[model samples]
Target: MKQSVTVEAGGARMPETTTPHHFVAGIGAGPANLSLAALAGRHLPERVVLFDRQSGPSWHSGMLGADARLQNSWIKDLVSLVDPCNRLSFLNYLVTTGRIFAFLNAQFTAVPRVEYARYLAWAAGELGTVHYGVDVVEVDFTDRFVVRGRNGAVATADHLVLGLGTRPRVPECFRSGTGLIEGAVLAEHLDAHLNRSEAPPAGQVIVVGGGQTGAEAVQCLIRRGYRDIRWLGRRHWFAPLDDSPPANDFYRPTYQKFFYQLPDEVRRSYLAEQAYTSDGISLDTLQEIYRANYEAFLRDGRAPVMLLPGRDVVRAGSTGGGLGLWCERGSGGRERHTAGLVVIATGREPAPMPLSAALHELVETDNAGEPLIEQDYSVRWKHSTAHKLFLQNRGRFTHGLADPNLSLLSVRSAMIVNSLADREAYTIRDEQVYTMWA
Candidate 1:
């Protein structure tokens, strides 16, 4: 039997088409939602349904550089943290794909990003619950949740899950006529641009933003034979990531619970203090950049990359047929530079919720207008508790820093699954608590 989805418009409906009401309808088929689908099980057909705008399973494909790797371990995959025996474990993916021994022999400290992306795709394919090429535009509720996509097909569900990941943050200075400045591209697109043309001009290439993306951009430029590269950052210096044991204690489930119970003001302070754990550039990347610069300096007279920190990009304009950037120095001074091309690697923020106007009014929000997510990952709304809306990758303020990190995907999904099933579907055990966070 062919299934049909009714299209709903303003005031009137398209036609009479039968649509199956799902127990849970998910809005993005990324890792977060994929984790939930993996643990939700395969016994029930209509238990979960996911929609994504992508035509296929793809994750950060633009930024998958040759040497790029994952920050977190492979053990924190879709289902491992909670249910390793689940059909969609990363280990299972390797074994089923007949590469377990080869992968073990490689013995990577952290797996490659490309491999992780393939693992995610394998999990998505194995689950077979994702509806690709469907962009969910609006979501509201009446008797049940109504999800309307850009293609006009609609779905209904008793509960909803939103796993819309983050989008790159465009700097304020780059908002020109078309909201984009020529010769300025995001770090994500730089690789594609380099692939098309691997040559550099006479003018220097400037990379803005000081985090991992910025570092990666500098490294990419260096590898492509761009000799004159300048890196600018707001921080005092290019700091390496603090992957120490004490810093990692904050990522445990017990610590996550503790951080959630803290006051909002304290949470903000802690996030500021502990931002580097999740945001800083890896030591391996730093060493590579330094080593590459050394090798280049040994061969050529001039170094490849110039590290300039404590400078904030204040303005940008055209000068000498190239882009010129003005910056305010942190130590009470100013500087300017001209570049043939500029790469913006600032950071990423969560994608906006696609809730309809009616649905938006029912949900409670913090001062920043972000939806307030509960401990179980459910949003606080005016509707009955029976119909819930859960949000992922948008609760960094309420939850700990682990909210946005991929280290706790399965644990967070387990929390949501337990709420939906109205039972303890997965047990989250963090018994090895040696560090007492005061």
Candidate 2:
């Protein structure tokens, strides 16, 4: 049975009415979803509800590593981008935990990823509008959407926000269990597992991909006293990110002006082209890894980092106890590496859970299968005109580059709230009927 309830909006208290009324529902509780909640808390009427599949607020549980440091500036945290003065800002979080002065004195450019995770959890705790562990199973649009959850919880919302974050994009070669290549998403527990394992012979590890996670994984294995490691990436080598304070202009609200004007096809192509830089590790991390490896090399001929540029994993099969990896190099050679284990730091792509077969049929799409959304991030379908669905994180292609990452989360939240406010105003102007019509 669906739990019926109402919440306070502005100075008015809404009652638990059974009639089809306007509703806002968020499907996932990641940073993107929580950012939406923070925005809504300040602006959304009390009727909105946020849904998360996890037991609590966890942005990226798989990638959360203790030794891992954020690749972005500290100001890019949840609340700070939107309202630096807000009590929920990271500065406030630090002050609450008595780390403000200490952090300031450290002279570090970024905070630890674990600490940032804690900040997300703290922010969620204060928001209080989110429903954790209540995984949204299906979203359908009639006059309103009947959102079904895992334990038979059905919620009717006029709008549904899908923050279904990226699914790890494991390459085709590593997927088959029969292959020697193992696709391991080195996040949370998996990181600990890799750390605890006895160092392989010669302490050699093969890491593919050059993103922030890949760099961190390399750092972790090296710090754990591993010496021989090869970082085989698609690019020439890890390139530095132009993260100068002014370069942040690429991620600011003003940047959206240029992003929005681009055609959808251009937007899609741009995201694919720039994924490496926008999501790649900062220059600082690159330097740290290089210095550590250089120190190891100077101490002995043993270098912790090896660069295999233009080499891509081609095929994988077990040679024996360990694993044999075959790769095609930029030159005319097929390089083979045998390691204790092969780790694919290959990043993630957005994967949306299938809604009910019927529900899926109700939503319309463009030339691609992506949802055709209005400017407010509402899915445009012939069947549901009254219902407004705010797609949280799934609109990267439609909403431009700012939709997916935490880069524009604060301003993105504000934008979404403005859209929701406009939606509410329209409903109010029409005197949106709260009861069934004849």
Candidate 3:
């Protein structure tokens, strides 16, 4: 029996009847969102929808260098921290692929980035309920979040997980044009560029940052055919081996207790101070590059890796023909370098979500005009809450330094799930949220 439904009833105008779809929808299929989906696949009997802008599973595919390795240990993969017993752990992936023996044979502490991505893809495939090529455009929170993708199709979820990843940070100097200077994340493309191209007449390629990306880019390019690559950094690139800080001490359970207890300002300060230690190139990677360059030097001709230590890139612009990068030296001097290509290996920042027009009134912003996220990483509502809106990768300042870093991603997922499971009783622990006193 088909009933015609097009009519104006009450104050609502009904055009046509639409089929109902039930789902707890997730936005973004990056590692963080995928981690949540994987857990849901294992635990949730109810329908769950996962959405990604990309066509399918890819973790930093743009920079998935064949030779690039992970900074964190294999145990620190997507799922192990939260659900070590989960079958989707990287160890499990290796075992399932029958590469456990081979991987162990390689005697590597951290798995290669490509291998990890493959593991993620395998997990995504088996998850079986993921939606590919669907970019969730808007989310409106009523009772649940009504998530709309690029198409007019909408999915309603009791909870929404926003794992929309970071955007590459392009500085103001590069506003003129990206072609003027090359800025790349995920180090491998630069490697390929250096591999295929000969050193320009300018001789040097300036890599601007001392972090992992910067160091890895310089190292990879120098390893390839590039003759001269200048690694510029605000701080001196120390021999990581000589300063091998214990990782456990920083991320230890005891430290986390103290860390969480500290005031937010102190926590921010602490994170700022440890940025180099946490995100810098590992001692091993740095040492390998240093050794390779040293060997090249010993061979008497091909040491092309030059470290512009203790300097910050102040300004960069096009020179007469090439590119001019001006820097401030830590030793109280300013210097400029002319390079054929200047690669900014700086990292990324979280991008904004397009909230639905219906729910704009409910959103509460922080003092800094950022969305107020709960400790469990849900956006707070002012009135008439319909559904839960969870943000996965979006809360950095609110959730502490662990938000974007892969440090506690899995545990965060688990906590999010637990919070969703017991939504009625959940309490947000973060200080960013406040009660609206009407």
Pairs of colliding residues, candidate 2: 62-187, 159-388
Best candidate (score: lDDT): 1
Candidate lDDT scores, in order, read 0.85, 0.67, 0.66
Compare the candidates by TM-score and give the number of the best one.
1
**Candidate 2 Cα lDDT to native:** 0.67
The sequence of per-residue lDDT tens digits that candidate 2 reaches over residues 260-293 is 6678778878778656547767777788888997
Total clashing pairs in model 2:
2
Looking at candidate 3, the ten consecutive residues that score lowest on lDDT are: 1-10
lDDT of 3 at 32: 86
Query: TM-score of predicted model 3?
Result: 0.83
User: What's the distance in Å from true for residue 226, model 2?
Assistant: 1.5
How far does residue 302 in candidate 3 sit from its true spot (Å)? Answer: 5.0
Kindly state the number of residue pairs that clash in model 1: 0
| Backbone clashes under 3 angstroms, per model | 0, 2, 4
- Cα-based lDDT at residue 291, candidate 2: 92
lDDT of 1 at 268: 95
- Winner by TM-score between candidate 3 and candidate 2: 2
Model 3, residue 284: displacement in angstroms? Answer: 0.8
